[model samples]
Target: MCRWLAYSGTPILLDELLYKTEHSLIDQSMHSKLGVETTNGDGVGVGWYEAGEQPVPALFRGIGPAWGDVNLRELARVTRSGLFLAHIRASTGTPVQQTNCHPFRYGRWLWCHNGAIHEFRELRRDLMMAIDPDLFPSISGSTDSEVMFYLALTFGLREEPVRAVERMAGFVEQVAKAHGVAEPMQMTVGTTDGDRVWAFRYSSVGKSRTLFYSTELNALRTMHPELEVLRGLSEETRLIVSEPLGELKGAWQPVPESSYGVIQKGADELGSFTPR
Candidate 1:
């Protein structure tokens, strides 16, 4: 279980989301209300796409807690990105290590996940063998979270993200059922390729992980005029997070269960999927 966020829109400093909100991601690092754990202190990570460059993303991950990390604070104050993924980890069975952090990257795609694979130890070896050997060595950590990233890649994430994820979930469920592990896999993942962003709120049980996305900017501006940060952001800029960052009532919208939402540079879209 973890608390995470995905931002896709106008370029803005990381502090705008990481440190500024009343109940920001940094705040959730210590006082999360919706996650499986109240405090996600295992580790934290951030990944963002640089503006006007290639689509590939750069990452910054540390084994330290998000609230206490000095480097995170300094970086938040200076770094800005139009597409970002930030995560606070609560390790289930895996050890807390740098490679285990979220916002895993491969080529042009950036990804993060919030949830765990049921009976990870039992299925770890089987699933690892399924990944393409070329990509397996790049998986530096032993967390089931990171393995899911490579699984999506093995199923073709680079070519078709939506289908890749669906197939990966299908494989996980299949492996779980064969082992008599009836519990469903839970996942609320966000991924992007610099031009478009996709967020998924899904679980095999149909009661998925908690996730949210922001409403249109014009409406927020109309509602809260005094908010100075709103002036710097564009009309198309949007944010998706595991929980509401602030007390602004209608500012956040819950992503429908079993749905995948897409935010391109110019348009927004959502589609449905059935988790097998």
Candidate 2:
């Protein structure tokens, strides 16, 4: 339902992934080839933690298409971070408002999601009631995407992201099944606390939303030998996106269904899970 990306390697201007590529996030905002929609105009956001910052990531969001937002263009051109999260939304039923945008922030954690809570209207109240009251008030958006974040927080994302997410997914599947809905969740999530980024490609069904991570820099460089920028970035530099940035074969690899990817400096690891 949306397109997103997370970078956890060399720090570069946001535009390098958000706008400059042959099929960057900006391009996917209006011309997505692998999304349900060609144009994702509801809203967009970006969050990045510069080195030395207190894990509280800086975020900028707007309820406008990415291509027409001059401010986002300017921000992308100037900002750089080793880890970045950017999303272009296609709101399933939520209103187009800045607060409803992705890259939602809370303390040191930043999160973004690219799918929906199936038949959300049926479980909105139930899910809301389940969020910790203290954290519930912090939720500023009406999107299920944000609620999912809060749910993960309730399950202990701050202290244990992997377990928290699995618990949250299990709870969601439980609630959905009670309403006679099967596979009521679909999501490709990116979350970080400045030091490491954890991304999940999952759904209640065996099949999940689209998510891909870049091949190792050394390997990708071998394929496109002329792309000079690859040489400057560290071998640890990696990118995870909702879709391939270009027709660059061997440049990206699909995150296996129902799996979570942990991107840390110098190494990438994946953990498999069954969402309830």
User: Which candidate has the highest lDDT of all?
Assistant: 2
TM-score of 2: 0.96
In model 2, which regions exceed 4 Å deviation?
none
> On residues 31-146, what C-alpha lDDT tens digit does candidate 2 reach at each position?
99888889999989999998986668899999988889999999999998898899999989989999999999999899999888899989888888999999988999898989
Instruction: Tell me the lDDT of model 2 at 209.
Output: 77
- Candidate 2 structure lDDT: 0.89
- lDDT per residue (tens digit) for residues 1-276 in model 1: 799998887888999889998999999999998988999998999998887877678889989999999999999899988888899998887889998888888888788899988888998888899999899778888888788889989998888888888898989999988898876588999888777888887887778889988989999999999988888889888999999998896799899988999988677998896553
- Model 1 has an lDDT value of 0.88
What's each prediction's TM-score? 0.96, 0.96
- Candidate 1 lDDT at 263 equals 89
Please report, in order, the local distance difference test score of every candidate based on alpha carbons: 0.88, 0.89
Local lDDT at 246 for model 2: 87
Error of 1 at 132 (Å): 1.6
Candidate 2 lowest-lDDT run of ten: 267-276
